[model samples]
Every structure is written in structure tokens, then in C-alpha cells.
Target: MTSSRSDTRSKIVDAAERLLREQGPTAVTTRAVAEGAGVQAPTIYRLFGDKDGLLDAVAEHVMATYVSAKAEIVRAASADDVDPVEDLRAGWRAQIEFGTANPTLFVLLSDPERARRSPAARTGMDVLRSRVHRVALAGRLRVGEERAVELIHAAGTGAVLTLLSTPPSDRDPGLADDLFDAVLRRILTDTAPFAEDGPLASAVALRAVTPALDMLSDAERQLLTEWLDRAISAASPVTR
Candidate 1:
């Protein structure tokens, strides 16, 4: 009985996913999905609650597969010793492509309330956080890991939305790349700075690994962390 119920749910979700992908969100009505999945409309209501509930299930299903593929790519790149900064760029480009290609899904996930509550969106953010952490370990990130992730995410989403608003033929091919570079400039150092007065980048990098350094006593580590935070704050760029 459990297996049969699960199968019914999968059929409905699969049908909804196809309708969303092929004809956009408006085509994913409960009646249409029930017809596509060869089930009665009440079956969809019993399984998914409503149209919004069904759409959420479809988003979760599709994005789970997409995020899993991206996770594998990141894992492979890390195992191969790809440059952390380059890997980050690759991830950024992949996200842009995904958003542009599936504008409907992208817009659905873009809803602030939905995005904040979404498991799939949180998984994607976790992936971004890991990539940013890698860059910080490499001494390339200039800002704190959380700040860098937030900046990159906002910039990438904005870039995709801007491009989507433009006609395909009239869209600037370099817009996304240019925006990415601009973000990189703000949040990452081209090279690790070793100077005494300009040790902010190094301080930020060291802070990421401080807990792993067993050589320092807890008190000593605390002192170092305080000092590093002051340095990082002093050197951080002021945003309007």
C-alpha cells in the first residue's frame, strides 16, 4: 500500500515537472497534471494539496537532480586539484546557464519566501558556501565567507534576471561574465597579499583554518581571532 501511494505521488510530480518545463508554470494546473499523469483530479488534491503544493514538489524534484549533478561536478573538480578560483567561476557560469535555460523554474525559486523555505535552494546555497570556503582556504577570498557568498549569490541572481528581461537577440552576451568579474574583484584578491599593513586577505584566510591549528592554546587562538577580525574590518571596503 505504501509503495503504491509513493508511485502515485511520483507520477503526479513527474507529470507536473514535464508540464512546467515544456509549457511554463501556467500549464501546470492540477487538472492538467492529473490528466497528464492518468489520475483523477481528486488524486492530485489528496497527494499534493493544491496547485502551489504540486509546484513546490515539482521544483524540489527537478532541483534535487540538478543540484546533485552540480555537487558531483564540484567533487570531481576538487579531487582533480582544479584551481579553487577557477572552480568557483565554473560553478557561477553553470548557475547562470541553469537559470537562463529554465526561466520558469528560476523565477519560481526566486520568490523570496519560497526561496528562504526551500530545501533545494538551501542545498544550492550550501554548495556555494563550500566553494567560497575553498577560495578562502586558498587565500583568494578578501571578505568573510558569509559575506562573499551573499554578494556572489545576489549578483548572479540579478544578472540572470536582467538578462531574462531582455529579448534573447538583444541580450548582451558579456553581461553575465562582466558582472561575475565585478563581483570577484569586490570579494576576492587576485593574489594573496603578504605585506604587514595589508594583511587583511591573509587574516581572513587564516581565520577560516584557525580552529584546525592545534598548536595554539584556546586563549591564544581567541586573541588571534580578535586581532584578525579588527584587521579584516579595517581593510574591508565600505559599501553604500
Candidate 2:
């Protein structure tokens, strides 16, 4: 019985996703979804509560599908063989493609409230965070991992939205790539740890590995991170 119910829920979500993709968010009425899925309107409410709830499920379904494919690609790549910065660039390009391809779903998930509540969004972010951590571990990151993640996320999200807002014929083909390079310039070091301002470079490198220090308590790590950020900022003219 549980399996049967779960199947029914999947069908409804699948139908809603198709409708949303084909006709946009405005067309995803409960009645339309019920007809598409061959289920009663009450079943949608029973399983998903309301239209907003159903939309949330649809967003999750689509995002999970995208993330799963990307996860497979990441798993297939040998970590030691991959350049972390290139890996990050590949992921960023994938995100841009996904967002532009699914404008309706992208806009829906753009809402801060919805994004915060989305399991799929969280999963996507976790993938991004892991990639950022890899860059840090390689000593290529110029800023704190969390700050780098936020900067990348914000830039990517803005680029997609900007492109979507423009008419396709008028959109700049290189805008996304330009924005990504700008982000990289801010977050990444050109060379690893031996350039001018060696102390700042060393501090940035150490901050990246702080999470792996088993001797430090959570508070100690946090405090250490703060000190490192301050030292890094003070020593680096670019960051000051």
C-alpha cells in the first residue's frame, strides 16, 4: 500500500513537471495536473497539501534529476587526476545550462523562502560546497571557503536571471563566461603560496585546511578561522 501511494505521488509530480515545463507555472493548476496524471484533484491535496506544495515537489523532482546526473559525472572523475579549478568551472557551466534550460523552475527556486526549504537546493549546494572545499584543499582559493561559495552562487544565479530576462536574440552569448571569470579572479590565487605577500598567501592556504585539524574543537576551529581571515585581510592589499 505504501508503495502504491508512493507511485501515485510520483505520477502526480511527473505530470506536474511536464505541465510546468511545457506551459509554464501558470498552467500547473490542480485540475490540469489531475487530468494529466489521471488522478483526482483530491489526491494532489492528500499527498501534497496545495498547489504551492505541489510546485515545491515538482522543483525538487527536477533539481534532483539534474543533481544526480552531475553527481555521476563527479564520481566518475578521478579526484587526483582532476584540476580543482577546472572542475569548479565545469560545474559552473553545468549550472548555467541547467538554469537557462529550465527558466520556470529556476525562477521558482530563486525565491529565498522556497530555496531555503528545498532539499534539492540543499543537495545542489552541498555539491558546490564540496567542489569549493577541493579548491581550498589544493591551496588555490584566495578567500574563505564559505565566502567563495556565496560569491560563486550569487554570481551564477545573477547571470542566469540576467540572461533569462533578456530576449534570446539579444542576449550576450559570453555574459555567463565573463561573470564566471570575474568570480574566479576574486576567489582564486593565480599561483600557489610562494608569490609576494607570502604570509597572506600562507594564511589563506592554512585557512583552507583548518577543517581537517582533528585536534581543534568546533569553537577553536571557528576562532582560528576568524583569526586567519583577519590576518589574511590585513596582509593582502587586494583584500584590504
**Model 2: residue 145 alpha-carbon error in angstroms:** 1.0
Q: Which pairs clash inside model 2? A: none
Q: Roughly what TM-score does model 1 have, to 2 decimal places?
A: 0.91
Residue pairs in collision within model 1: none
Model 2 lDDT-worst window of ten: 192-201
RMSD, candidate 2, Å? 2.3
Per-candidate TM-scores read 0.91, 0.90
lDDT of 1 by residue, 1-240 (tens): 999999999999999989998998889988899899999999998988899999888888878888988888888987898898899999999999999998888888899988988898999999998889888888876677778999999999999999899999999999999999999888877563454323667878998898788999999988888887777776776331
Clashes of each: 0, 0
- Runs in model 2 lying further than 4 Å from the true structure: 78-80, 215-223, 233-239
Error of 1 at 53 (Å): 0.7
lDDT tens readout by residue for model 2, 1-240: 999999999999999999999999989999999999999999999999999999999999999999887776666553455887888999999999999999999999999999999988998898898788778777776676777889999999999999999999999999999999998888777684375544555677788788888899999999998999887766554455
Which regions of candidate 1 are displaced past 4 Å? 192-198, 215-227, 238-240
For model 2 the local lDDT of residue 185 reads 83
**Number of the top-ranking candidate, with TM-score as the measure:** 1
